[model samples]
Target: MALWKHLVQAASAITLAAAFTSVASAQETVNIGYTGPLSGGAALYGKNTLVGLEMAAKEINEAGGFEVGGKKYKFNIVALDDKYSPSEAAVNAKRLKSQNNTPMVFTPHSGGAFAIQAFNEQDNFILGAYTSVPNMTERGNKLTLRIPPSFAGYVQPFINVEMKAFGKKLAMAGGDHDYAKAWAQLFGPAWKQAGGEIVAENPMSYNKDTDFYSGVSRVLAANPDVLFVGGASEPTALVAKQARELGFKGGFVVMDQAKLDEMAAVVGGMDMLEGSVGVLPLIYDKRPGTEAFIAKFKKLYDRNPGTEASYHYSTLNAVSEAMKLAGTVSDPKAIHAKLSEAYGKLPPERNPARITSVDDRGGTNANIVVGMVKNGKVETIEAASLGQ
Candidate 1:
């Protein structure tokens, strides 16, 4: 009897240990990757995006992470600084895919996003973020997910509104970056479509360019009724300031990169940004859902968020929603399908005013809001009426 009792106790202990091990093994973690220029001229852009991403992740985790297959797993973020280099972005993307096995990556800029998209197309993972270039999604890459309205979609309204107000002749200036080139190419065709003419188009190299005298001189000589500055904060601001100094007193159309605060800082104040038009909506206007996000962002970072930052934040939320819908994050195919479904099912409160649904190619049908920089802030000039 003593021996039998000892054997029974041993069996009980073994069964309990096995059950505990199974439970622990069932708990998994979902890792997400973020790649961008954490250090460089675009560092601020990357930093703001990171802040929003982190905020979203924290909130999700605090809410008991995410549920999948009746099991709960915490979400983790693995961020790498690509320093705004395409080659570095490719390398980081490969690492995330092979080494870390990350399910999705959030890229804020065009160059980095493009590089990752190239690899993700083959790997069957998800690449989500805001990139204005339509080609990023137009090529039918099954993995690429864009958050913003394409430059082609957003620029038309801008042209109609500005051309009617300022005249037909237009001058275009942009950073010599890949994204700016893409924007320039798109704008040229779109401007012509809208009964406008591009009198001159010039490209300026970024980082190595601090002086816009030569480019501004050429633009001023063209004497366009309106000027379009395409690039990130600093370069666009420099071009705008120099154009004004050179006595080209005309309305300006800033591109997606020129956020309200950065433009104001570059032009010395809100007065300089006054009358400048851009593609993003006024996010700080204390709208119902937006006010909470803006308030949280400011409370955490003590600064207003930009388009890039907001897009990144939304991407995080969308990812969480996708995971919940799919009930698993390990399978990229399942997650991708779930993302499409979740986007359609998203409540009005969770959806952005622009994007209605995620298309088959993972592209969101997001509309654009045309706004003017006034009093050092972006104010909505017109809500984009799609197909107009």
Candidate 2:
């Protein structure tokens, strides 16, 4: 009787162990790849993007993961640093696709996006491009998703605001990166079209050069009323600071890549950023979605979130929702097709930028808010008012 009782207990224990194993195996992991400048001058920018992606992934997993085709799956971000190099981005994409079978890859900078775009459709992975450059989505890569609305709309408004405040003699002093080059090219002609004159153009390496005295001096020598400057936020701030030190008392046309608030942090205060125009600082946005996102992000990161964090965070959440709507986690094409529906499902609290929909070519659409520093405060310049 004692032997029979012991055998019954052992069988019950074995059954329980098998049940635990089955439960563990039920939820699978889906790898999502990210390749950006995680270890270079733009490390902060890259880290912000990664933080947003990871934060959203953690939230999804904590809520029991998303389900598709009657199976549950959680996201696992497979992040690799490309040091802001386009060639390295391409290599990372190949590795992510071959090894992890990631259905999507996110790249923050336009250079990396363009490089990956060259082969992303071929690799069957969606490109979560975080660039504002209009051409990124215009190329028509079927699997690409432009996270931020195009900077194209900003050109007219930017020229209008800066030209109104400062004289029309524009001097180019932005970074030499692909993104900045594109912005300069776009702005130069537009500045001319808007009845502005191009006085001087000087492109310097924002990442490599520390003392921009020579470059800024050259641009300042042109006696232009407005300086076109941008790169990553920190370096851009340094350039602006150096220009101020050189006695440049003109307005600035800042590119959308560098956040004005972040630059203010580096340059002491908004006093230094006075007369500068760029993308509106996220903190200034009074939308309920923006406020909720900032609160949640601050709780997690212990600091204010910028456009980099907000945009990437919303993009990741939207992508996850797309997977659920498409009812497949592995098919990039299907997922891309469902993005519009996915964005619609995002609640107000989840969609910080309040992106309503994506265009047919893949770019996300929303009102572009332009901010200008006046009296040491960021004042909103509605895109509608600017005729964007």
Candidate 3:
């Protein structure tokens, strides 16, 4: 009888150990790879984007993980800094796919998005682009998606106002990347049609550019009524600051890639960014959806979420919900299709209002409200005022 008791106790211990192991294995982790500029001039853009991505992951994991394949999988990100370089992004994408086995990878710019797109189809992964370039979805890559309204839409309204209020002479300066090149090229025809003359076009490598004094001086000498401050918030702010110091104060036509509020802090005065207009800030949008996101984001990060990161947040939430609907986290193709189907059907609990708009190419056709810096903040302008 004593020997029988010993055997039964050993069997009970084995059962308990097996139960613990089963529970631990049930909560599997799903990692998504993200590539962007985390330590360069565009670090703020990349970091803010990552902040939203991570916040989404944390919220999903906190809600007992995303259900897939009859098991619960926690979402996480294996992010790498690509410095907004296509070459680095390609290499990073390859590594993330082969080594990390991530179903999706996030890139914040057109260059990186294109690099990943060149081969992501073959590698079988989704390219989540937090980009402002229209070409991102123009090619019809089934796996690629644009995050926000393209830089393509920002020019018509901007030039409409600048040509009338500022003057007819305009000069453009930006990096030679795909998005910057697209911005400069797309704005020219609009400017010309609106009775504005393109006085000069100066393109530099943001990766190599340390000082804009030389470019700003030369461009200012051309007697431009508006200097197009291009690229992300940091470089755009830098251009605004340098231009102000160089005494070019007619007007600053900021690009949509950067956040105006962030740039306002850098340039440090309404006098500097006065008459400057770009994308509308979420704080200014005041939509119930946007306001709620702002409140939730502020509660966690103690600050307002910017445009780029907010797109990232929407993408993450949408992707996870799609995965749950797809019922297979490993299949990118299924998840991508399900993403299109589940776009607006996301549960209200999972930031339902974020499904604001989705174009045919899976890109978000978010609003393109250009506002000038009034009273040290971005004040929205009526599109009708610009004849847009």
Candidate 4:
């Protein structure tokens, strides 16, 4: 009787082990690629973008992963640092496609996105572009997906507000990077068209130069009513602080690359950011799903999620949904076609940016919330009315 009881216990243990193995065998991994500035002046921005993708992947895995083509799949993000260089980004894309066979590669900067666009179709991977540059989708790349709405929508509203509050004269003191340069180019002509004068144009290297006093002072010498300055949040804050130190008490038209909330953190508070206009930071978003997403993000990372983090998180979730709808995890064309449908299918909680549709050119349409620093507080001056 003792021998029989021992044999029965051994049999039960074997059955449990087999069940665990079976469950493990049923799950498969799907690789996704992220190439951006993991180190350098733009490191924080890149890290924020990566965390968003990682957070979404984590949530999807915790929910037992999504199913596609009759197989259960979990996500594995293969990340590489490009140091914010377009050439390095191109190299990383080749490696990701050759080694991991990733169906998609996300890049935060416009330069890197354009670099990838040159060859993403040939390599059969989708370019998950995070840039708001209108040309990102306009060039007709089949597998390209522009996560954020075009920055073109901000020009008119910015002109309306700044030209009214400040004066007709504007000075350009933004970063010299490709993204900032594009912004300055757009703003300069638009500001002129709106009956404003470009008193000065001084582009600074916001990434490399810590001392923006020279550039800021140069722009201030023009005695402009509004200073157009922005880059990454840190350096942009420095530029604004120095302008204030120099007694330039006028309004500011901040480029969208530099977040107002992050700039405020660096320069002390919202009081320092009075009369600034830019994208509405996710923390100030009163949309229905934004609060819950922020709460979840804070619980996970122990800090507030910015527009970069929230947008990427929601975009990644939409991509995963697109995969399921396309019925395959590896086909870029199918997933691209289904993206619009998939975006509408997401539960509101999973979509903090509130993406509504994907157009034929692969650009997303959403409520581009714009905010302004008015009387020491960030207020939503425009929402849903623009970027539709």
Off by over 4 Å in 1: 1-26, 281-285, 347-354, 374-377, 385-387
Instruction: Put down candidate 1 lDDT per residue, 280-378, tens digits, no spaces.
Output: 544644455556677677788787766666666666777778888877777777787776666666553344333556777667765456776655667
Model 2 segments beyond 4 Å from truth?
1-27
Give the per-residue Cα lDDT of candidate 2 at 79.
98
Off by over 4 Å in 3: 1-28, 38-44, 68-73, 81-85, 175-178, 204-214, 245-249, 346-355, 382-388
Give TM-scores for every candidate, taking all chains together and pairing residue i with residue i: 0.87, 0.89, 0.83, 0.89
lDDT of each: 0.74, 0.89, 0.78, 0.89
Model 1 TM-score on a 0 to 1 scale: 0.87
Q: For model 2, how does the per-residue alpha-carbon lDDT over 119-210 read when each residue is reduced to its tens digit? A: 89988999999988898888979989999898888899999999999899999999998789989989999999989999999999997888
Q: Residues 1-388, candidate 4: write the lDDT tens digits.
A: 9999999999999999999978766447788999999998779889999998999999999999888888888899999999999999999999999998899999998889999998999999999999999999999899999999889878888777788888999999999998898898899999999899999999999889999888888999999999999888899999999999999988889888889998999999987779998888899998779999999999998999988888888888998899999998888999899999988888878999888889999999886778889999988966445322
Instruction: Report the number of backbone clashes for model 1.
Output: 0
RMSD value for candidate 3? 3.5
- Each model's backbone clash number: 0, 0, 0, 0
Error of 4 at 296 (Å): 0.3
Give the best candidate by TM-score: 2
Pairs that clash in candidate 1: none
User: Candidate 3's error at 249, in angstroms?
Assistant: 4.3
State the lDDT of candidate 3 residue by residue for 1-388, as single tens digits. 9999999999999999999988776447777999989997778778988987898898888989877777888887999999979899999999999988999998887778888888998999999887767778888788876777667767888887776678999988777766677788788777887788889888766656768888888888898999886776777888888888888767777777667777777767556788787777767766566677788888998987786666777778888878888888889988887775565765444442354556768676544557877656678775546666
Better of 1 and 2 by TM-score: 2
Q: What lDDT does model 1 reach?
A: 0.74
Say which prediction, candidate 1 or candidate 4, comes out ahead on lDDT.
Answer: 4
Residue 240 in model 2: shift from native, Å?
A: 2.4
